[model samples]
Target: MRQNPERRTALLDAAIEVLAREGSRGLTLRAVDAEAGVPTGTASNYFRNREQLLVQILHRTRERLVPDEATLTGPFDTAALLRDLVARMRRERSVHIAMLELRLEGTRRPELQAELAAFHGAELSENIRWHQDAGLPGDRHEIVLLYLAMLGLIVDDLTTPAVLEPYSVDGLIDAMVARLLPEQPVN
Candidate 1:
């Protein structure tokens, strides 16, 4: 019932670890509190129930997964930005793994579907902000497509290396970016 920012974050980290290690079925406030090494009631103090805890996981994943805006700026270097994105994904791999697990569980749960939708809406808002900041030409629909494509690529890059040479990370990113953005004249 009490709010402690640091403990709440610790609980979220523990939840991610539990989800990654044991899947959504392992995610309960008691489990999270135990994993966090906090008191038995700590996680429940922060999250009302399992759905609420899962929603927090989604929020934390969105917060941790999006490429930092400050890092994404300066030049329109799709390859470099994507490289950075991949690096972030690798560095926070557990969070992403948990997200993937949640995405699967969401298919069977309506509350989770709503929470996942909010996570995606937040992601799209960030994409739109990045596009506007970079002076990129894509509107929301195009951005949505681009985001989905890149998400697929990210999952593939993390799980399985490109089976085809043309689909290698660099080639894949270049192709995705080229398809999304309008052509520019040579300098």
Candidate 2:
């Protein structure tokens, strides 16, 4: 099969749209083809199977969630970063829903579980690198805790929308920053 990046991206976008609008249960090759304005055979030709298509969508989602290396810098403004993270999460609602579905699907599919784990591991690595660059003082255990806390925020925001009102991401970031970097009193 010819490698047409544009067509592939279009198909992936279509898949995400379908999943977002109709949920994972409604996702099908024909649906994606119609959404992408491509023929059903073309969609099938690109993704040999439904599983492969779903995996591709997940991969694309991972790419969006993980910040670029260039964006990871030292002494990051925690509040600003938190706001950006929140925005990114909100923008990727479809991906989040798809991830939840993927987790359930992983129960019977070991390969899916492995893929999810690998993606999570990569996310952790990126977080660790960002923390190191930010001059944060902590061992791997501490950094892991921070990362877990961030994940908790994401999950909470998604599952319980009410949490966002009382404790905004910016507020959480402020609290975390205070704990991570105590202020030095002026002389």
Candidate 3:
């Protein structure tokens, strides 16, 4: 018998909730099944093992956290986009923490590491496209560096909330624009 799409989505949602609440170390198929109010066999039917379940949860997270393709196009407000991205990080604090924990776990697991790298590469590609549409110079390599730096700043701000109390996401965007864009010569 085929599983219901809604039930599958519910299971994934429950998995994320469990991950956010318990961190990677605490996640288990039994726990997810319990959280979803389903039988253990049901959860097992969908995800044969813990690793498969984790990969699905991470993939769902990427689906939720990453902006859609339409939103990446130009003619939209770049500052607003940056603010939205920062706000997403702030709002999904638990998820972000869980992701960090999973990343650390990935160090010992080559498959998980490769999965994360692919996700990062995709994010970098989208960011590069956004910058290119905004008339920025340099290739994907330069753009990826800038993207990683921006992510680092956001993560730093989140980790040390007090250190950047006065700085807003807008300020970060301004700094990035200043560094990445060339100044026009005064006429």
lDDT of each: 0.80, 0.75, 0.74
Off by over 4 Å in 3: 68-70, 133-139, 183-187
Q: List candidate 2 stretches off by more than 4 Å.
A: 66-75, 180-187
Question: How well does candidate 1 score on lDDT at residue 2?
Answer: 64
Q: Could you tell me how far off, in angstroms, the CA of residue 23 lies in candidate 1 after the best superposition? A: 0.7
Identify the superior model by TM-score, candidate 1 or candidate 3: 1
How well is each residue in 1-187 modelled by candidate 3, as lDDT tens digits?
Answer: 2378788788887888787788787788888889999977687888878888878777877766877676666666545666777778888776676677668768988998898889767766776786777764546666666677677877776678776778775787867756754453556
Q: Arrange candidates by TM-score, highest first: which order?
A: 1, 2, 3
Per-residue lDDT value at 110 in model 3: 93
State TM-scores per candidate.
0.84, 0.81, 0.80
TM-score of model 1 (CA atoms)? 0.84
Report lDDT (Cα) of residue 38, candidate 1.
84
The TM-score leader among the candidates is: 1
- lDDT value, candidate 3, whole model: 0.74
TM-score of 3: 0.80
Instruction: Tell me which residue pairs clash in candidate 3.
Output: none
Q: What is candidate 2's CA lDDT for residue 170?
A: 78
